[model samples]
Target: MDNSQTSILRRTVSSDTYKRLCSLWQQMAERKGQDSILLTEETLFSVNPSLAEKKYRERFCLLFSPEFRALLIGTLRTEDLLYQISIIWDTRTIADFVDRLSEESGQRTEIQCLRDRLQQILIAQPSNNPDLQCHFTLKLLDILTPETLGGLEQMYPRVSICKPVEDALRQQVTQERLLNQVITQIRQSLELPVILETAVKEVRSFLQVDRLVIYQFINESSAENERNHSSQSLGRVTYESRASDRIPSILNLTAEDDCFTYIPRYTEKYRRGLVVAIEDVEKAYSSSFCLVELLRQRDVKAKLIAPIVVEEKLWGLLIAHQCFETRQWFESEKNFLGQIGEHLAVAIYQAQLYAEVQQQKNTFEQRVIERTQELRDTLLAAQSAHQSKNEFLGNMSHELRTPLTSVIGLSGTLLHWSDRGSALSLAKQRQYIQMIQDSGKQLLELINEILDFAQLEAGKVLLNTKEFSLQNLSRQVLKNLQTEATNQQIHLELDCRVEPRHDRFYADPDRLQQILFHLLKNAIKFTPADGTVILRVWKENNYAVFQVEDTGIGISEDQLPLLFEKFQQLEKSRQRTHGGTGLGLALTKQLVELHRGTIEVESTVGKGSLFTVRLPNQSHRQLKTTPASKVEERVTFESKSIVLIERDEEVATLMCELLTAATYQVVWLIDSTTAIGQIELLCPSLAIVDRNIPDVYHISKTLKKLQTTKSIKILLLSDKITSTDWQSLSRKGIDDYLLKPIQPHLLLQRVSALVSSDQNSENDKMKL
Candidate 1:
C-alpha cells in the first residue's frame, strides 16, 4: 500500500483501446500460429502440466475469454481501486503456476528465459512504436523481479482466508448507516408508533434476525416487581417485525413465570445496562421449565433482550429472536442492540413529554374557548343592563315630572286664585286639593320603590317575621287590587287552597303582604279590560305557595329572564300602556329571597302569565335546624376560596387534592395567561401561583394594582429559592413563598394559613 511497494497500474482500456489491442493480438497470432503475447490455452496448460489435457483443456480455455481478462484487469493495482485479486484467483493458482515453472530448471534461469522471450515478442512486433518497446521492456523486467512477487505474496498471503474482510467492512458501514437512519427517524418524527415500526423492521433486517419486537408493559414498569419483571411473564409485545410467516409471533403471549421471581439475574443485568443474549434458550434455561417452554412455543431458538429504561423505570425491552436455529451472538451485535434500546427509551421519553405538552396545550385552548364564551355572554348581559339603565334614566325623568307637574300646578293655581281675591266654587277647591294629594302620593310611591331596591342590593334588608294568616293576606291583596281590576273590567278572585289552621305560618306580615300586593297589582296592570286575575294561596311541603295567575297581555319567554333583573321591564308596553319603573318584580324577588323563599314564573306570549312564590311557612324556632339538608346553612371562614396558577399536572393534582380534602374551594388555572382575569373575577382570598410562570411577577403586580384584587393574598411556589430571589418577588407583590416538590400536609397548612389570614407580611416564607 506504500508508494515504493505499489505498482502504477494505469488501465487504458476503452472501446477504442480494446479494438487496437485486439487487432495487435490478431496480427501476432497470425504470425506466430496459435501462440501470442496474450494468454492462450497451451500457456495455461504449461502452468498446470500434470493436468489430463483432454479433461481440463475446456476449463483452462476459460481464462483466455474476454470476460475473464476484463475481470483480471479489474483486479490490478491502482490508488483508488480495491485490490480484489481473491475475487478472480486465489493463492493456489499462483503457487501452482510458480511451482510448475520452477520444476523445469533453476528458478532464476527459468524466470530470466521467460522474461527474455516476452521481451523479444514485444520488441519484434513490426510497428512504428519505439517508445512503447522500451517502456514495455522496463515493465516486463519489473514484473519478473523476485522482490515484487514476494511483496504481493506478503501483502495478500492467502486471498481465500481474507475473503470475508470485504464483507465485514461493508457490514460495518451498513450498520453505521442503519443506526444513523434510526436516530434520524427519532429526531424527525413525533409519531411514536411510526418511528418504532420503522425502527423494528430496519433493525430486524440489519441483525438478520427472524423477528424483532418491543415488549412494552401493560402494568406500569418497576424495578421492584419480581413477578412482572421476569422474562416468562414479561410485558406484552407492543410492536413486532417478522422475517416471514414461518416465524411465530409472540405478540400477546403469556406464560407462567414463578421461577423468574426466584432468579432475577436476567432483569438485574438489564438494569445495569447489560444485554442478555440467549444463544440457546433451550440449553441455557433448561433449569427453568417455564422460560424454556415459553421460548419453544414462540419458536425462539435464540434471543437478544435489551431493556428500554426511561427515567430509571424499566419501561420495556427491545427483543430480537432467531426462530430457525440457535445462534452465536457477537459482542458487537449485543452492544448495538443494547444501544438501540437506549435510543428507543429516549424516543419514548420524548414522545411522552410531547404528548403531555400537547394535552396541556389542548386543555388550555379548551379552557380559553369556554372562558371566552362566558366572557362574551357576560359582556352582552352588561351591555343590555346598561341600555336598560339609560332607558330607566329617561323614564324616571318623565315619571317624576308628571307627578310634580300636577302637584305644583294644582297648588300654584289654588294659591293664585286665593291671592287674586277671587271667590271660586268649593267643588273646584276640593277637586284641586284632591288632585294635588293624588300626585304627591304617586311621587312618594316611586321614591319608596327605588329606596327599597337600593336597600336590598346593599344587603341591609332584614325580615320582621310574624305568623300572618295566608287567608287574610290573600283577601287584603285582592281587596287592594279590586278597584284597579274593576276599572279595567278584569275579574278578581282569591283561591286559598289551604286549611285555615295551616295558613297561619311564619313570615314577615308587612313584607308578605307587600309580596302579594305587588304580584296582584302587576297582574291587574297587564290584563286587558275583560281578562281575569286570581290570587291563589296554598301550602305544600311545609312551605307557603302563593301563585298569582292571570289571563292578561302575557310576557314572552325571552323577557321572563329579564323580568326579575333590576331596571328591567316589558319595554313593548312600558311606552304605551304600563307606567312607573322596571323594579316591581326585581324588588319582589329580593324580598322573597330575604325570607328564605323562591319565586318562579311561567308565561305565554299571548295567553296568560303565572307567578309562583314559595316561602318557608315555619315559625322562627323552625329556622334553627332543617332535617332534609344535612349540611349547616351558616357561612364560615372554612369557605375560603383559592385560585391555583400552576401548569404542572402532577404538582397541581397533588395540591388540588389536598386543598379539596381540607374543604377549600380551589380554581385551577392550567393557562397562566388567564391568571389575572380569574383573580379579578373570583376575587379569591388567595392566589397560589407557581414561580415557573414566565409572568409571575407581572401577574402579582397587576393584582396588587387593581382595587378589587389588591387585598387578595398571594402565595408564590418555586422548586428552589435563594435569599436573592425573595427581594425581587417581594417587590412584585408576592406576599409569601413556598418551595415546591410539594409536601401534602405542608402544602395544605400553607394554603390554609394564607387563605385564613386577611393579609400577609412580606417576610412570611416557607421552604421545602
Candidate 2:
C-alpha cells in the first residue's frame, strides 16, 4: 500500500471506473458494515510479484467492467459467499495465498470467528433485499479461511433449491390440467352456442382481457339444416366492473377470408400459435380494417387472435381483446387461448357430425313413407279391378244364357217336327240354323275377349311379329267384313297413301288384323246404309300411322273418355243391337302399348270419329326374326293327358265329337266327381276337367296322388276364371286353361299339339 502502487491503481481505474467502483463499495458498506471495503490492486501486488510486473491498468479495466462485475454479483446473495469466493479464487491464486498466510500467523482466528459469526447472521437473515445479500457475500469471503470452504458452500442458494420457483411451476402444471378438464366437460355437456360462450368467457378470464369472441366462417353453400343451427353470435364480458357497451361487435370486422391470413409468419417466434396479434390496433394494417376501427373507436388497443381448427382444418377464429393501452401478452396467456380454440374446434366437429346423422335419418324416413303410400295405391287399384270383373261376369252370364237357351229350344223343335206334314219349311229351317250359328259366334267372341283381357292384365300377352304387306292384310279384313258391310249397304273405302304393293311393314299381323276387323265391325254396326267407313295408311317419322275413320253415329264428348275402357258400352240400352263384349278397343290399346306405340281417337259428336294407330317402325335388324311358316302354323300346347272330364252333358258331347275328329282317343267322364278314378284306370294322356265341377280340389288332389297322373297335363275349362282361381290352379300344377263354349277348330289344334309335344319330350327325357 505504497504511494507508487497507489498511483498505478489510480491510473488503472479511470475517472468513470473510479466513480462506479466507489458507488458500488459505498452501497455495499451501507447495506453490510464499515469494515466491508473493496480489496485494491496494490494489496494484491504486494503478495504476488508476477502481479506487480503485469499490466495493472489492463487487468483492472477487465475486473471493473460491467460484464465482469455482473458475473461476480448479479445473482449472488449473502448465503452465496463461498460460491463467489471459489469463482474468484479460480481466476487468481493470490487471494487464497493471502488467506493461508493470515491463518498461519494466528491472527486468522479473529477474522475466522468474525466470519463464522457473520455467516450465522447472514444465513438467518430473510431474503428480502438482493443488495444486502450481495454485500454480505463479498465481506464474509474477505475474512474466512479460503481452505476448508466446503461448509460455507452449503449456505449458498443454488437455483435448484429455490422452493418458491418449484412451487410456481407445480401450480402452473395443475392449472393446465384443471383447465383441460373444464374444457372437456363444457364441450360434452353443452350445445355449440353454449360451448362457444363458455370458451370465450374462460379465455377472457385467463388472458385478463376485457372481452372475448368466437367468429366462425360461414360457408356460402351451407345446407338448410346447417343455416338454422350455425353460431351467429358469441361473446362475453371478462370483468363485471367493465361497461357492457364496451363490448364492441366482433362481426362488423371479420369476413370469410380474414381468418388465418397473416398467422403463419410469427407462429415460430411467439410459439403460442396465434393467427394475429394486434399489439396496437391504430398502427397495424389488418384485413379486419373496419373491425380495427370499431375497436379503436371503443378504446381497444391490444388483441390476440387464434385460429379455430376443426378436424385439422381451419374453421374460424377466437379473438381476445383489451380495452386500454397495448398489453404485452405472456407465453402462458397465449397457450391458454390456444387451448380454448382447440376445444372449440372439436366441439364444432361433433356438432356437425350429429347434424349429418339427423339428416340421413330424416331422408330414410321420407323414403319409407313414400314407398308405403305407393303400395297402398296399388292395392286399392287391384281391389277396384276385382270388383269390376265380378260385375261384368254377372251381366254376361244373363246375356249369354238367354240367347243360348232359345237356340237350343228352337233346334229341338225343328228336329221333332221333321216327320210331320206340318214340319217347318226349308226356308224357316235355314233361318233357325242361321240363328243358332249367329248366337254361337256372339258367344265365342265374348269368350275370346275375356281371355284376351285376362292375358293382358296378367302381363302375359305375346306378339307374333313378322314382315307382311299392310295392303294385303287390309284387303283380307275387307273381304271378311264385305258380307256384313254389304248387308248394311255401307261403303268401305281404302285410302292407300303409299303404293298398295309397296306397303310392306313389320308388325304382329294377326293382332293387327284382329284390331282392324273389330274397328270395321263397330263402324258397320253404327253407320247408316249410305255412310262410308275409310281405312287410311301413311308413314310419319319412324312410325306407320293407320287410321280408321267412320261416318257413323258418332260419340259424344262425355262418352269419349270411356271409349277404351273394358265393358264400357256407349249405349247401355242399345247394347244388344250393337252387340259386343265392349273389350275390343281396350284390347287394341293394350296391345299397341305393349309394342311401345300409341293409339289416339278424334271425333265430333254428330260428324264422325277417327281412330289412329301408331306403331314404331324399328329397323328390321333390331326386330326379332320371324319364325318359319311351318313353325308359326304349329301351335304349342302345354298339356297332353286326354281325360274328357266335362260336367255338362251337351258341352261334353260336343267336346267328344271335336276330340274324335282330331283322332284323339278320349276317356270320357260325365262328371268330374268320378274323373280321378277314371284317370287312374285309363292313365289318360291328358285330363280335360271342368273347373266348376263338384269336389274340384279333391279331383286335383287325387290326380296328384296317382303316380302316372302326377305329371299329367290337366286342362281346366271354365265359363270364367278369376285371378285367385287361376293362381290356385297354377299352384296345383294345372297345365292350361280353356274357356267354354269351345271352338271345334281351336280344340282340335290344341289337342294335336299337346299330344305331339308331350310324346317328343318324354322320348327325349327317356334318352337322357
Candidate 3:
C-alpha cells in the first residue's frame, strides 16, 4: 500500500482508527501459516487491495482513541451505532471460505485476568466457548467506498449497504456489550448488591422497559418454619430500575405488600429454565382478579420473567415490566432475558463461594489467636511453677541442715566430755540431751512431711477410717501445740460445739490427730507474741466443721490462689522468721480433699486469717467387712443353727466360735449383700445382727418378710440400746433388743431364751 491508499483510508475514517487497524493487519499477516486461517493470497488481494492484505481474526480488540472519537461520533452519540463492538464476525462469513481454506481448528482459549486477592473466585477458564468459532461478518464501514465496495467491478456489485448492516450489527453488539458489562461487574466486585444493581439498571435500559427488578426469595428453611407470612417476608424486590416515577415502584414489595400477596407457583418449571412472558396482564390473568388489580395498580401492561437458578435451586427471579402500552412477546427477547438470568446465576454462585471462603479465613484467624493465647498462659504457669519449686529447694537445704548441724554439734560435745572423764552436772547434761532429742524429732518431722507429700502426689495414700471422738482428738491436738504456743507467748483457745451424740464422727483416728496437730501448730507458729489463736469445732448436719482463726499477720488476697500449691511459701521476707518446710498448707489441702472434704481460707492483709475445713461423715465406710466367713458344712439342730450379721471382726469371730462350741451350725457375715443367701442355705433359726452394719435396719426387715425366715428370732445388739426402748425395737421385727457388753454367758442365755420363744410360737401354730 502507498501514500495514496493511506490517504484514501484517512479520508474515509479517522487517521488514528485506520492506522491502528493497519498495524494489527500487518501483525496478523506476518504470522503466516502459524495458525490455520480461511484466507489465501489471491482471494485476499483480488477484490479489494486493502482488505486483501488483511488477515482474518474472529476476535479483535476495539480501542477508542480521543482523536478518533472526536473525528467520528464523539461522547454525545448515545445511540446503538455508537456502542462498541466486541466481536465483528458472525457465521455467514465463515461459510464463504469453508470450502477454500478451512481446517478443524474450533478450540480457542482466553485466560481471565483478575486481582491477586480475587484470583480464587473464578469458576474456571472460559475457553472452548462455542461463541468464539464464528467468522467475521460486520466489515469496517469506515474504510468502504463506492468504488471499492464494488469489489473489482465483476464478482460483486454495489456493496455499500451501510444503514441496514450497521443497525443489525449495532443490535447484536449492544446485547453482547450488556452481558460483558455484567461479567465485568461480577469479576470486579464481590458485593452482590452492587452487581445486581448495576445489572438491573443496564438491562432495563437495553430492553427499554419501564421497570426491572430482582426478586429474591427468602430461605426455604426459614420460610417453612415461619407461621406469619407478614413477618416472614417470603420474597422481596431487592434491586430495581425504573424509567419513570409515574409507574409505581415495587422496589421493596414482599408477600405482605399490598396486592403483592400472590406468589407465582412455577418454581419447579423456572428451575428448569422456563421463561414467563405475559403480552397483556388483563388478557393473561382474565379470571385472576387479584393479579390483574396488582398489575393495574402498578400501571404494568406486560411482564417478562426469567428465573435465576443457582446450584439447581431457584434463588430468585429477573423480571421486566412494560408499563406504557400493551407489548408483544418475542422469542429473541425471552431468550436474551434467560441468558441474562444464567449469567446472574454464575455471579450469584461466585459471590456466595467468595463469602464462605472469607468467613472460613476469619474463623481460622480467630482460632489461631485463641490458641496462641492459650500457649502463652501455659508457658507462664510452667515458669511460675518452676520458680516456686526452685525456691522450695533452697528453703529445704536450710531446713535439712539446721537439725543435722544440731545433732552433729551436740553429740560431738557429749563425746568430748565423756572422753575427758569430766562428766557435767546432771541438769546440764540432761538439758543438752533434751535439745538433741528435740532436734532429732524436728528433723524426722521434716522428712515425714516430704514423704507424705510424695505419697499423696503419687496417689498411694489410702484412708483407714474408724469411729473416733472429736473432742478427745481436739484435746490431744491442743496439748501438743500448748508448749509451742506458750513459748511463742500466744494465747491458745478451743471451743468445741459438737453435741455429745455427734462428737464420735467417723475418720482415721491417727490421721485426724495429725490434721489437727498440724493446723494448731501452724496457728501457733504464725501468731505474733501476745496474739490469740482460737480453734473452733462444730457439727452441721452430717459434716463436722473445723475452723482455725488467728489474730496474726494474715495472708494477702493476691497470694490466696497459690497458697495451697506445692512448695509455695508466701511473704518471702518473713520466710526466715517463721522457718519450716513449705509443704504444710499444701499437705493440709491434699489431706482434706483425700477424704472428699473441702478447705477454704479468708484473710485480710494485716488483720487476721481464718482457715475452715469441712469433713463429711463417712461412718458407713468405717467398717472392714468379712463376707460369709467360717460357714459350717453341716447343721445338726435346725433350730439351733444361726446366721451372724456383724461388722466387728473380733465380735463376729467370738460369736461364731461360741455357737459352734455349743454344737450349732454357724455362718458369720459382715457384708449385708450375702447375709440372706447364707441364712437361707443354712436354714438358721436365729440371726444375730450388729448395729455397726450400715443396713442393719433393712436387714432385719427383709429377713422377717421371707416365709422361711419369718419364724426366725432376730437378736439386735447396740451400745446405746436401753431397757425402755425394747417396745419400740420389738415392733421393728426384733424379738429382743439386748444392750452391748455382751458376755459369752450372757449372749448364750439370751440366744437360748429367744430360740425357745420362737419354738413355743411355732408349736402353738402347729397345735392350731
Number of clashing pairs per prediction, in order: 0, 8, 2
Q: Please name the candidate that would achieve the greatest TM-score relative to the true structure.
A: 1
Compared with the true structure, the alpha-carbon lDDT of candidate 1 equals 0.69
For model 1, name the residue pairs that clash: none
Better of 1 and 2 by TM-score: 1
Q: Global lDDT of each model?
A: 0.69, 0.60, 0.68
Q: Give the per-residue lDDT digits (tens) of candidate 1, residues 1-768.
A: 232111122222223333333344344334445443344335545555554344441211112111111112223234422233221222223224434444542444544554455334334541212232233323333332345445545655542233244344345456656777777888888899998999899999999999999888664344545634544455578899999988877777644446465565556666767788888998888888877877787888999988888887778888999998999987668867887888888899999999999999998998899899999999998998899889888788988999999999989999998998995689999999988998998899899999999988876666655667788878887887787788889999988898966767787888888888788888888888789998888888668898899998888877777888888777743455678788888899988877657899999977899999988654454334323221122111122678899888878878888888887778899887887876776667889999888998899999999976787889999976768888878998998888767877778777778766753431142111
Residue 346 of model 1 has an lDDT of 84
For every model shown, what is its TM-score relative to the native structure? Answer: 0.58, 0.45, 0.56
**Number of the top candidate by lDDT?**
1
Q: lDDT per residue, candidate 3, 537-652, as tens digits?
A: 99987688999999888888888998888888785824478787789888888888666677899998667889999887753421243122211211122456778888887678
Off by over 4 Å in 2: 1-328, 353-361, 364-368, 419-423, 455-461, 475-496, 499-502, 519-535, 548-579, 601-610, 624-768
Model 3 whole-model lDDT (C-alpha atoms): 0.68
Per-residue error for 363 in candidate 1, Å, reads 4.8
Q: Which ten residues in a row have the lowest lDDT in candidate 3?
A: 63-72
Candidate 1 regions exceeding 4 Å error are 1-160, 163-169, 218-236, 248-274, 279-297, 324-328, 357-382, 420-434, 464-468, 507-509, 572-575, 595-597, 616-768
Q: Which digits, one per residue and each the tens of the lDDT, describe model 2 over residues 345-399?
A: 7777888887888887896898799789999989987885676566556568766
lDDT of 1 at 720: 69
Candidate 1 weakest lDDT stretch, 10 residues = 62-71
